[model samples]
Target: MTRIAACQLAPVPDGLAANAELTADAVREALAQGADVVILPQLVTTGGVLEDAEQARAVAVASGHGVFAAWAAACTARQGSVVVGGFCEAGDDGQLYNSAAVVDATGLRAVYRCAHLWDRERVVFAAGSAPPPVVDTAHGRIGVLVNYDLRFPEWTRTAALAGADLLAVPVAWPAAQPGEGGGPDGQLVAAATARLERVAVACADRSGPGWTAGSCIVSASGQLLAAAGPGRSAAWADVDPEASRDKLVAGSSDLWLDRRPELYDRLTAPRSTSG
Candidate 1:
């Protein structure tokens, strides 16, 4: 079992220095608590600045530079732990993506771009066309599904089918979006976890009235393990990847049941001209 921690923070807008410092503080806190893996919210650097694309791109860092690399070194020095956090990337083509990086001893492990950009994100960031959940870590196979990926069941299912024992989500879930107010994230999270019984960590920004939307971690059996609200707070969960796989094979552990794929496909099928 690996001890994991999620940092849910209210990041200051465009304050790169302070943001990095605050984020580092949370990482240290998680390490102090014996976390072998720590996950942080999406867009930790510049907040949710969808209006200013250039500014967003300016803050974007390459895989091996800046805060992401620093965190990786810290984790490696501590105990060869893994760290994940959302960020923007200035690609070689000069386009930027809403990305999340998996950090470890050697530096960045895998960088995932947000495939499903929500609302105004399309303007500030280019949509990532790749599917998620790359299983390339020392601890075990872990998948990354950034914010807005939560709205689609197929994304999570795709990861589960691809052999992800654990799924980590970095979100900026707003307090008032849809049924999100008053623990809606928990219910949605439980339902999603129940679909593919893998330990999931959804680290969200403590945003409301403009940014950050708290965070939560759910067990494989649709149970809300821990959650945090607005402020620089974090939560810890012990995840057993082998046990996660074992739970799926146990049948009654609530992994991959009641998934009505045929029904969805039929509904999505285009109407025939015969009508």
Candidate 2:
């Protein structure tokens, strides 16, 4: 009976106060709507794809300064509620990472950094070492993947293999151009891709002119259970971990069950230039 909400709302650029308010509002709404876990999009506190110079290097608050802290405290106050959201993590070594924190009413649960940095992000954020997948509270083995992380199937595959029942993605996906008209693929591709592993993939993507419009949830066999409206809304859905597991156990796919790593190694063998 764990219902997670993937919020799709407009978070103003560099507007921490506004973002915090928005996050609190969403958390409240999710709880009111009977959500056990409420997942927010990446950079929920600080707007992503920073454009302004001053905004580009915005420092991360110490689990106390801004929205991240505010959200954490709010979640803790909610008793049974938990929150998973992203923000820039300021490390003790003085490095800022593109990171996400899994929090509950008690405070921080797990902090995951983005291992794969996309386009402009590499220039501003330091990467984190990819850690072995771990379950958060045993309700289900949870794993985190930032936006660009979804492009690589192995990332999701490894998590599934490592016992992740729910693969959560937080993204600030971009809206297709004025006329290009290819609606967001976060869900379409994730669901299609997850069909390979037969795992549930849930994503909280941003909306409006700054980010992609669609936020969605995919079933264990890649079925679209729910989708957010175009731009600024929450996508609500119920994910039965048991059902996801059941589908994987019953479904047939070459994803992990029929892997032939040995053959792949030879197939992808590098060729020598010295012929």
Write model 1 residue lDDT over 1-275, tens digit each, in one string.
Answer: 77778777767777777777777777777887788778888888766555768778767777666787678657755666888888777777778888888887677788889999988888888888788856567666788888888667778778776767678777877655544545656446544664455545445454556443456667665566776655546666776677556544555644456556667786557879998
Cα RMSD to native, each candidate?
3.8, 3.7
Give the residue spans of candidate 1 off by over 4 A.
178-181, 197-199, 207-213, 247-275
User: What local distance difference test score does each model get?
Assistant: 0.71, 0.71
TM-score (C-alpha, index-matched) for candidate 1: 0.83
| TM-score to true structure, per model | 0.83, 0.84
TM-score of 2: 0.84
